[model samples]
Target: MNNISSISNPIRAPRAAFLGSNLHHHHHRLTILPRRPNVVVCSSSVSTPTSPSLSVAQEANRIGSLSQVSGVLGCQWGDEGKGKLVDILAHHFDIVARCQNEREAVKLFHEIKGATPNHVTYTTLIDGYCTINDLEEALRLCKVMEAKGLYPGVVTYNSILRKLCEEGRIRDANKLLHEMSERKVVPDNGGANAGHTIYNAEGKKFALHLVPSGILNEDTLCVIGNGVVVHLPGLFEEIDGLESNGVSCEGRILVSDRAHLLFDFHQEVDGLREFELAKSFIGTTKRGIGPCYSSKVIRNGIRVGDLRHMDTFPQKLDVLLLDAASRFQGFNYGTEMLREEVEKYKRYAERLEPFIADTVHVMNDAILENKKILVEGGQATMLDIDFGTYPFVTSSSPSAGGICTGLGIAPRVVGDLIGVVKAYTTRVGSGPFPTEILGQGGDLLRFAGQEFGTTTGRPRRCGWLDIVALKYSCQINGFSSLNLTKLDVLSDLPEIRLGVSYKHINGTPIKSFPADLRLLEQLKASGISYEVLPGWKSDISSIRNYADLPLAARTYVERIEELCGVPVHYIGIGPGRDALIVK
Candidate 1:
């Protein structure tokens, strides 16, 4: 009566079936009698029974159970003729059944259930339910057996719950755990079966490895791109302030020798071009990121190393300024203005000399010396040049792949790509957001998380965490772990919504994140679904330990890990660098 034909009847008890050689019984006929309401008794008729009305449970007590029935029947009643009859019938019970594209194994179960119906019988049925991922039904059956005074035991509970977690139903699995806790049902094996699954999930492929913070003795080096221009300086300045507060970086900082410089003029030119020149705004930081990258590509870009040779730099500057002046109608650079700029850059170059070097060699040498290198990715994955939303995307790569080209470092030298993401979603400037909270809700999060741009101070657009996009990012980077930040911002929200997946206008699900920009936007325009979790009241920002986090917050974090298949090794509770909960 199950979905899996007769064999998957959800009642297959252990000892119901067996496989062996030369098995024979002295009793010629084995009877399948419903001697009682729900029991089937399979016993021999070699000896006359004192009572013909005994139940299978009584018969099993009268005789031994599986061990008695499985092998040679009875030596006392053994006869060559009767043994031949039982041996001939053994083909029906002994022959292995391999059903392809068919149904088949509950026959043996029915034979055993009527006889014993003990604790082992009930537990086996529970295991059957778990194999089919039906914990609810298993728990219900467990209660029935418990009412009859048979303990289902921890073995049954662990088996069912372990399978539930494997299929990513950890939430329901946890509920059963609550019941077990209330009953004080300890595990029958080493720890619980649930723990084994998590251990297996985090085995070699996703093992958590922690190193002491600030392990870099040589110095901390950050690789930049158009990608980095708006973000790194602010971060370095904050590190300097931390140094002022007695938290020092202790090592020198290296900027790539080949990295295109973002001059003040580049920012000036970017603002003028975006607001004045183009038909469609590029939605830039007005920090000249794209222009600088553009300059790099066309072979006219001035780099950090170019500042060393002042005599030749002015000539490169003159060509650049003259070209930019002609291209931008808003810019008017007279010869005197150009001369003033030349002198201005000469002084700036002198100041930059100390920080500039052939950083590629430095990074390579650091690898040789076995010094750790931590590369911070610029911009989010959705803003990546090639893989992200086009037209509205940034000009340079912000992906893990970008680290190689931007830093002049090889890909093999890279290690432990940890992704930093907010508890909810937010993006600067403009782009398509699937789970965007457009009204007061978004504004609340914006205010709560200080969702403003580091470069332009523009208030960021906010939304729910998009698993579609997050999965895409995780797949591309093969992230070792995640650093979930701004979780405390959702504390005040009585109920927080999480986007799980996307569907089309016709309600057909998008199998994978669509490459078509409009199609991807369409998938979420009105159709992404959410799973809601209740919000926590505690101020998690000051809670430095993950175990100290509130129940609701833990549920939220676990749900995210379950969805993305990446553990949140570090949780950020507040703004300071110290405000991290390490798992």
Candidate 2:
């Protein structure tokens, strides 16, 4: 097998050849890749198992090492036949992964191989519109991909780069690079800390000061991470009447099976009189919202919708939870103390009662009322169950489409998708991020952004705006408008810089976003190529209009508009809801 080289060849020729001469002058430099390559059958080294089955342990091992190699197959451009390679390789692998690339990668992978529909793992779909450049078709396909949950990866970047180069968009290219840098986004690649202690007057929140007087509150630190460190300072100014709900402990909580019985009892009363009685003890974390649905699927769970058939619902839940508890008991709990703590949560379940309702009915009524509801996503797009970075992704979809699944709403009612993005990109868990900044700067972004996990409270992985990745992300989410938050963080800086396309990765041109971690690490290690912009000293927090802000901030926003190809519907000057400039 030929080992793919870590280095890519840079185009030594003039821009004319990069886009083929077969087209008009505007698109002459674009490289249109060949769709799919023929499959070459490779002999398998391992003998087929005679039993056609394996032990649970063996199955786990098989799935864990699904991909034989540690690296990814990449091309200089999109049509490098990666899909064909993935299809060919899937025979030896358990799953194929795609992100920040076109959805075709997965579609082609399965199409060519005739894999079962169940075998393919489709994740997030992103939409893009180069309507200004007549690339709306590509963007539309991206939305379809998003609906199906197949994420774009490096190919998306390569295709866009090829498109820009073909259009002879040198100025736009530079601007794109500039926006990418400030946002810390790589053109084709998509890809936190502690403090001095100060508390709000409410004592519910604390701040950390690294600089001598940089104001180290938790909220400010959440925006950025690193700077000079200081020892425990005296009690700082507090916000009047703030409630401190900070965490100081961790353990598991268990719930009992009898919790479902309360709903059944309520059903018997018809008016939920009993259900109302138990509502006080529900102790529901609301996270169990999914668990109720899971019970219905197995025909062993109780749902309020099934309350009309309470006799069946309670019996089913009782059987399932008991079986679950019995199985859980046999499993080793390592420490007795841990087991006891878990039982405590389980015991708490008895005190609570759940309501039985056909949530589907509630949703249908909402539709009838024609109400405008904004479904709050529990997590970021990166943690989405399907499109996210695989096993690392969350168990549920949090993207726009998640609204349909989570709430059982018809997709037709969904209108005007608005995407909320920070000035810089952030991800909570592990995944391939091609443009992560390291060392002092990364630490700085972390400290400044207070980049901690909102749910996990663990530190987040911070980087510049990854246009390549964000493009894919926005496309999947069908973003009609963007609310860009935190442009003011760049305020007071000596000079603000944004990432552009890289000159090379490991001595080679970064023609595409490389997936190999070793190469990616090296590409990131090469540091970033920044397009510096003058910083503004004015406080943008008070500015309400786009044109009314300082020229520098306007220039920054305009430059971003040009690169993203999407208008900034709203620019956030501060964290508060009112701190927005709607253009």
Q: Which stretches of candidate 2 lie over 4 Å from their true place?
A: 1-315, 322-357, 454-457, 497-523, 526-532
Q: Report each candidate's C-alpha RMSD, comma-separated, in the order given.
A: 29.1, 26.6
TM-score attained by model 2: 0.45
* Residue runs of model 1 more than 4 Å from their true location after superposition: 1-251, 277-285, 454-457
Task: Quote each prediction's TM-score.
Answer: 0.59, 0.45
Clashing residue pairs, backbone N/CA/C < 3 A, model 1: 40-114, 225-228
Candidate 1 per-residue C-alpha lDDT over 502-533 given as tens digits, one digit per residue, 9 for 90 to 100? 77878777777667656655544456766655
TM-score of 1: 0.59
Q: 510 in model 1: Cα distance from truth in Å? A: 0.9
lDDT, candidates in the order shown: 0.51, 0.37
In model 1, how large is the Cα lDDT of residue 413? 61
lDDT of 2 at 302: 45
Worst 10 residues of 1 by lDDT: 96-105
